[model samples]
Structures are given as C-alpha cells and as structure tokens.
Target: MIKRKWSILFLLGLSFASVCQAGGDIDALYSRIAQKDIQALNELKALAKDNNAQALAELGFIYEYGVSVSVDIPQAIKYYEQACDLDGDYGCFNAAYFYEYGIGTQKDITQAKTLAKQLREKINLSNINLDKKVSER
Candidate 1:
C-alpha cells in the first residue's frame, strides 16, 4: 500500500511537471507568434499532433478568432473537441458554449449540459485530489 501511494505521488508529480512545461512552451509560442515568427504556428501544430491538450485548445482559439489564419469555425470546433476529449477545461468550456449557442454547429443543449457537468466533476475531482495529497503530505 505504501509503495502504491508513492507511485501515485510520483505520477502526479510528473503530470504537474508536464503541465508546467506545457504552459511555459505555450507562453513562449505566444510571444513568438506576437513577434510575427512564422514558425510558431508550425510548432503549435506539432505540439497539437503530439496530443498536447493545451496546444489543441490554443489551435482552437486561433482558428475561432482567425488570429493568423482564416476564421474556420468547423476547424476550431474540431480542435476544441479534441482538447476536450483530453480533459482540457478551456476546450470543454468553449465547446460547450459553441454547442449551446449554435455557433458553427447545430445547437445541442444536451451536449452542452453534459460537457458542463463533466467539467464541473473534473474540477471537483481535482480539488479532492489536491486535498487528499496535502493531507497525506
């Protein structure tokens, strides 16, 4: 049991480190994009291809607002769904909003509600896990 707990903690630590790394990468990429660094988009795409949840959500935002590319709602929705599937909160929220308002896709209140509920649960679970970890520590 002690070994299992240690393993779980190790995994959690790794996940936290990766999340920090991803956030740092995203910030750097955003800065580069702002400086008109043409390779930034390619790097973001590569990160998305690697199944980085944040990268996928960033792509969704870029496509949704036509930041550097043409506005493509369908593509944005596609990226959002991909990120949502990976448990990205931003992606889930935006996807839910789009579904709720019939922006770019057919209005589906049921799907929106489901997404909202799932997101809430995820947030709750994360909080619970954090509390548990702190107590254990």
Candidate 2:
C-alpha cells in the first residue's frame, strides 16, 4: 500500500514537472496582459487552471474591473474565492469586499459578515466550505 502511494505521488510530481516544462521556454503571457489584450488574456488564462491562486487572482482582477475583459463580478468572485483558499491575500480582500458590497451575488449580511471576519482572522480563506455551509442553512 505504501509503495502504491509513493508511486502515485511520484507520477503526480512528474506530471506537474512536465506541465511546467512543456510550456515552451517559459511563455510571457504577462506581456499580452500588460498590453491590455483581452483575447490573449483569455488564452493565457486557459493554460492555467482556475484553482491556481495566481491564475485565480489575475482572473478575478480582470473580470472584476474589466481590465482586459468584460466586467463579470460573479466570475471575479468565483476566482477570488479559489485564489483566497490558496493563500492569496489580494483574493481574500477582493472576495470579502465583493461579498460585502452585494456585487454579482444577492446581498447577504450573514455571509458578508462571516467572510469579513474570516479574512481578518484566517491566514488563508477559501469560500467553498463556506458556500456549502450557507447552502445547507
């Protein structure tokens, strides 16, 4: 059993390494982002998974403020929630703020309050569990 676990870990590690390496001499998708090209931003974002904090945060900002894409507050909140769960400070702030302001989502004082408190007290905040809790209630 232990050997199988090790094998699985090794395979996953190799997969991640290959993904990082296969992107061709390290692409500079950031350049297109800096140039304010929304289509390029979309393509680059597709390359990085939404769960990745950096990607999530960038996506959040882009959607939230219409930087390189259409204004999509809900999409911003979704990405911020993912990023914050991964220890992104900016994500925490953005998610909490958006929740508080009732942007994209119906305003819920309880959720907003809980999120605000979470940001102040938790080092890393992820809203997936919180959303589950709210749904259950």
Candidate 3:
C-alpha cells in the first residue's frame, strides 16, 4: 500500500513539474511571437508541435489568424479539429465557431449546437476543473 501511494505521489509530482516547465517555454514563445521574430517563432513552433495540446491549438490560431502565414480557413478548420479531438477548450471553441459561422463548412445552426454540446461533454471529462468555461465557449 505504501509503495502504491509513493508511486502515485511521484507521478503527481512529475506531472506538476512537466506543466511548470512547459509554461516557461510557452511564455518565451509568446514573447518571440510578440516581437514578430519569424525564425524564432518557427523554431519554437517545431519545438511545441511534438508534445502539447497548446501547440496544436496555437497552430489552429496561427492558421486562422494568418500570423506569418497565408490565411486558409480550411487549413485552420483542420488544425482546430485536430486540437479539439485532443480535448483543447480553445480548439473546441474555434472549431464550433468556424462551423457555426460557415468559415469552411456551411453554416448550420443545428450542427453547431450539437458540436458545442459534444465538445462540452468531452471537455468536461478531460478537464473537469474548467467545466464552467465550456458554456462560455
């Protein structure tokens, strides 16, 4: 029993440590992006793409906003959908919004509402702490 408890604690600690490390890089990336350093941003993006939900969501945002890239709504939709599938709230919101607004897909209110509900349910299961934000999205 003590061994099991120790293992759990170790895992929890590691999880916290990983999250903290990720925040530092994310901050640095944001700063680079703010400075409009395209080369650094691309390098940071490659670093991010391997290991995070945020990376995928940021990819979606970049495609959506055309930050240092061409605006391609279909590509934006594809990236957002990828992040949404990975349980990202921002991704879910953007995906549903694009679908709702007919940015890529045809506007269909019923489909939008349905996807919104599905995203909320999935987000609830994956990120229980932010369930309230689901409705806001």
**Which candidate number has the best lDDT?**
1
TM-score of each: 0.75, 0.58, 0.70
Clashing pairs in 3: none
Alpha-carbon shift of residue 19 in model 3 (angstroms): 2.4
Write down the TM-score for model 2.
Answer: 0.58
| Candidate 2 lDDT over residue span 1-137, tens digit each | 99999999999999998767644312455557767866668765775474566667777877888875679999999888877777766787778767666779887657655665565556544543544444443
Off by over 4 Å in 3: 1-4, 44-51, 125-137
lDDT of 1 by residue, 1-137 (tens): 99999999999999999889889999789678666676998999899999998999999998898877789998998999898888888888788788777899998777777666666666665543322222232
RMSD of 2: 7.3
Give candidates' CA RMSD values in order. Answer: 8.9, 7.3, 5.0
The better-scoring model by TM-score among 1 and 2 is 1
lDDT of 1: 0.81
lDDT (Cα) of model 2? 0.69
Cα deviation of 51, candidate 2, in Å: 3.0
lDDT of each: 0.81, 0.69, 0.70
